[model samples]
Target: MATLIVEVDDNKLKMVKDVLKAMGVSVDKKSIKPEKAPNETTALAIKDARNGKVTKVESIDVLFKSI
Candidate 1:
């Protein structure tokens, strides 16, 4: 037995599945898991960025100074 893996964008998932089905491939829904939600730290970072809490540095010197 052989295994093939494909990563498809969310918007194109249905189309890709339909194409695979037409080609006689068995699309295993059970094996496909939904994407995981961001962890607490990542979620907070994203929220902060969305709320304009990001820092912009124009040079290495400035970046190192900020860090």
Candidate 2:
């Protein structure tokens, strides 16, 4: 037995599940709700973003490099 988590696009999600089902796979379904309010640091970050305190990135390379 194996378990995995996958993130899929909303538009393609049903097609993906249907294909897996047709292939004789069990798609044990569950939807986990997001936790409330986030953590303290995450809350602060969200607050900052809402307040327009973020820096604008000029290049995609710079964004990826920073991460």
Off by over 4 Å in 1: 29-67
Q: Please provide TM-scores, in order, for all candidate models, with all chains considered together.
A: 0.41, 0.42
- In the range 1-67, model 2's lDDT, one tens digit per residue, is 4332344556756875786678676865434339664666556655665676755454434533664
Task: Find the candidate with the highest TM-score and give its number.
Answer: 2
lDDT agreement of model 2 with the native: 0.55
Per-residue lDDT over 1-67 for candidate 1, one digit per residue giving the tens place of the 0 to 100 score: 3233344556767876786678787874323334877666556655765676754345433433553
Judge candidate 1 against the unseen true structure and give its global Cα lDDT, from 0 to 1.
Answer: 0.55
lDDT of each: 0.55, 0.55
Candidate 1: TM-score? 0.41
Runs in model 2 lying further than 4 Å from the true structure: 36-67
